[model samples]
Target: MNQRALFAAAAATVLSSALLNMAPAAAQDMGKDMGKEKCYGIAKAGQNDCANLSGSHSCAGQAKTDMSKDEWKYVAKGTCKQMSGLTADEAKMSMTKKM
Candidate 1:
């Protein structure tokens, strides 16, 4: 390959390698954040966390119903049970009322 092409290939390879190495480290950093709390029944439809408890799906933004009792999302710790937010029990109650 020409010198310019060789240089571009080398740069791309290095960038790709750096990104691969960073992925796991970024995931670890995310796990270390203990301030997050899982708040159940507060997520709007299509806005829950990574997955539903019932194994219906394994991705966020896939919830079929809003404020579902079994749905949960992580928020700042203690924020979910505040006066404005609903605790897990409270969420279940709200869902029961709507049913």
Candidate 2:
């Protein structure tokens, strides 16, 4: 390839990789939303849900809150880790678990 063509290809490759890296962060944000919503539903019953959510690529830790006084006093929040090989199904399962 000519110098100009080669440079263009390199730029494209870099941009593609950057976007790929960002995708996991986006997906994790979505998963966190899912987990937080589920946490709300379970919070009333005072249950701790610790499902691994990051598609097995990364395991996002659960947010810890003190539930000493009342169930509503504490809440769990989850955020997906930014990484590759994570699937939607895995994220869903991580967010929604029977407690």
lDDT of 1 by residue, 19-59 (tens): 76665345334523967766777778988765665567666
For all predicted structures, in order, the TM-scores are 0.53, 0.36
User: Clash pairs of candidate 1?
Assistant: none
Whole-model lDDT per candidate: 0.70, 0.39
Candidate 2 differs from the real structure by a C-alpha RMSD in angstroms, to one decimal, of: 14.4
The residue-level lDDT of candidate 2 at 78 comes to 36
lDDT of 1 at 81: 72
Which lDDT value does model 1 have at 16?
89
In model 2, pairs of residues that clash are: none
lDDT of 1 at 14: 100
Point out the worst 10-residue segment of candidate 2 by lDDT: 66-75
Cα displacement (angstroms), candidate 1, residue 6, comes to: 29
